[model samples]
Target: RSIHVDSPPSVPSLTTSYVHGTSSVSLLYQTVGQRLDSTVQRWPEREAVVCVQDGIRRTFSQFQQDVDKAAAGLLALGLRPGDRLGVWGPNMYEWILFQFATAKAGIILVSLNTAYQANEVEFALKKVQNATDVAFKSHSLTSLTQS
Candidate 1:
């Protein structure tokens, strides 16, 4: 009996540089609220967001104003720094508002899927210890908290 084995061929090394075509730009080290405020100050009249389906449009200044109001509302609801706030809803203007509002209010925003089931929602709520859930449609803060 006899056995024979052949050694594997060596792979050719790539001479091309892996870092080619990559570039870096210095990013601003500022909070979301600070960036938004700076942008609003720079471009007050520029359109920031427009939801045609909802017939809603807002300029940078207007959007910042709304964000402030939303932040104030969260504060009035007793949301404080380090508090978790869940935002579960389909894409809408309110979602954007909440995103900025939570950032400004220093509340951690836990985003739940719009298609999440009751169990999934419950799991997320419990996991994050969310103080409040803001759902634009169908669900409300009271309903989520109660469950």
Candidate 2:
């Protein structure tokens, strides 16, 4: 299948160097949840995630279960598909779970850097708020931040 556009851009890009591959392979249009489900079906017992700091490990099946639960929780909190959810945390197993959870929940995940100060986070939240409707009615970042 061709991935090229039917028509080129009306405006000319004088410095752009666009290239399309001539390979016979077609792209797999699937979400992260779909791919995870496929992997679990193929290799349920295979190791999917491991956090060195916490010594946390999980197989594909376990990972899928946790991600599904988190996704459900997000939905329960009134976050629907296309809703924006901002996640602020450091690199941890929980963060990975939310990464997959957001994708599975069909909510856009706005990853806030762990190093971001309170002011920066406020600015980011405001910035995204201006562009899209961010859901924070029930799912607050209070627990994730320093008290």
Candidate 1 local accuracy as lDDT? 0.79
lDDT per residue for candidate 2 within 17-79, as digits (tens), equals 564444355566999999999999999999999888867789999898888887887787788
Q: What is the TM-score of each candidate against the true structure?
A: 0.76, 0.72
- Candidate 1: list runs displaced more than 4 Å: 1-23, 138-147
Model 1, residue 42: C-alpha shift (Å): 0.7
- The Cα error of candidate 1 at residue 97, in Å, is 0.6
Q: How well is each residue in 1-147 modelled by candidate 1, as lDDT tens digits?
A: 332234433554657623222224444799999999999999999999998766778999988888887788788788897899998888777888789889988999999997889999999899877788877874232222221
Go through the candidates in order and give each one's C-alpha lDDT.
Answer: 0.79, 0.75
- Model 2 off-target regions past 4 Å? 1-25, 130-147
